[model samples]
Target: MGIIRTTVITGLLGTSSAAAYLAARNPVISPLAANDPIWASKVFKKHNPSRNPVTQDVCIKRIPFSKIRPELLQNDGPLALEFCRGVWSGWGFAVQRRYLDFKWRGPETSQHLWTNEQLADSTYEKGTAITDHFEVVDKTPSAITVRCGDSPRNQALRPSDGLFEISATIDRQREEVELRLKSCLFSSQGKMDGVKGPMPSWMEELHQWYARIWAETGSWRLLK
Candidate 1:
């Protein structure tokens, strides 16, 4: 992640099918900036960037559809939206290795709210530089997509005008919900898949840990 390019980051957030991995050559990479296919799958596949010198570092994971939350489907307040935020914020705290400022931000629109921001001087990608801006870029009764505005990974690897749109999308189903996290760069050469390198096991573990917790326990917290 080097430079952020132009274009309003289409597919900023979307549902899943793959899991993209973005890690440095060194192991034990930061959890936040590690491999996240939800957003990565959408960015790469939707954008279908070119791989000149670097091969697209991509991975996708498809969650088996599950039952949908009634309140979420009924346009009941902002619980549906907040659910997405909770999943993301949870990861932020883990990545930053700090929880002092990972409080809830409600939501983006007044529809009750769902999003969060923190300037934790986090060690991870965007968390390292900017106050992570995880906003609901797109949404509906069934799905919501969130994007990070100032990810460190994007600014570090992309070429001049090269930018990364790292985001995640949550889709609700009658009995099957799915999540897709992704990271992709838009450079002078179009969309770049990822920096050339395999995501480390340690770094991968960190992300996996957060995701598992989010899917298992975190969702319940948001339900309340």
Candidate 2:
């Protein structure tokens, strides 16, 4: 397969045409952070090995309190999780990865398909799966941490895994709630253990750009 086609297939997450419309409507979804925060360093260490380097990217947005429902004001965590869910669900359904979604949700799991309101109201326990590949590994009042591994390929390349986190902080003083999306990607064990793949510079750049677009789109979806 061609590099672009292969890159899309191997992409960390899928995006929708709707996201493009969202981006065009609100070109500046959030303020882009130059680098990941200090707290992210500890999170990366816990999931990945010290030998393998991890790339981190973060996008931040603060929603005004007036925009949020009065009932949701009690806790920032739930709202954060809601935004996280919106992001996950949008990405999954866009690519129509229903088989993967069903396989991960399992027959016992109720609400295989979650609506925006459902995502906002539901509580995600540890091990809960969203977007097929993303599993909630950690959940706290303020943040939700999910992990996903790329599908195996026929080539001798090391499998890649992405650790994504969504965090919400209520700023009563500022009268706005802040939501952050942090993504960390690393190569997992395979033929290229401890060595990064020789991905073309263009592909790497494209992936990063794609991720940013997804983040912006996801973040914006929470408001609508």
Candidate 3:
């Protein structure tokens, strides 16, 4: 029993010392570590590609102009200038128009809300324009909803026929912003041929835009 115990203790110490030596030699093991079975497994797990790469349609909407506070709109020129500045500074894009038209009260006394920023014309000019319109869908003192689209743009560029929508809502109560994007890709030339996938890159870009907008407006905390 004494000899067996001595052997076990020696074995454990040997294993511990070997492990420490190995760890010291390779202090950091990246995901691509060639000798690491765990790293190899992780890399292999991410190698997923499909012949039928899913595509999504494009769309965008905004909150209504009417629901925005009058104070927010009190100085249209300065407000627009500020918003435009934010848009350009945040996204590195320029716009031709400062404000979007909003029809209310039988369209006679309608109002206009400035866009946070417009996409650079060069970005969409080459594509077939699908739809480009803005409308006020809702109004309230605390909140507003507006919807806009570039279906014409999509229609021109889409390889096949499909529907895409992108809309955003500003929550005055929570001071939060949410964007909803839906895309449907279809083979315009064929039947029963389509796929759907999330637009992670686009979503990431939108988030950056939001952050830039907040920074430009000096309202970073307003959307908390």
Per-candidate TM-score against the hidden true structure:
0.38, 0.63, 0.25
Q: Which rank order by TM-score, best down to worst?
A: 2, 1, 3
Give a tens-digit lDDT track for model 1, residues 147-169: 34332234332343222222223
- Most TM-score-accurate candidate: 2
Model 2 lDDT tens row, 1-224: 13443344345335666445434432332223535353345545555544364455555666788776666567876677766766655552344344554444554445433344555455777766553455676778888887755431211223567577778778999998777666666664533343343344565545445544455545655563
In candidate 3, stretches whose alpha carbon ends up further than 4 angstroms from where it belongs are 1-158, 161-164, 194-224
lDDT of 3 by residue, 1-83 (tens): 12332333234335655435423321221112235232233211221112123333222223344534444444333333333
- Predictions in order: lDDT: 0.33, 0.56, 0.29
Worst 10 residues of 2 by lDDT: 150-159
User: Per lDDT, what order, best first?
Assistant: 2, 1, 3
Report the error of model 3 at residue 44, Å: 37
| Candidate 2 Cα deviation (angstroms), residue 54 | 1.7
Candidate 2 lDDT for residue 204:
50
Per-residue error (Å), model 3, residue 74: 11
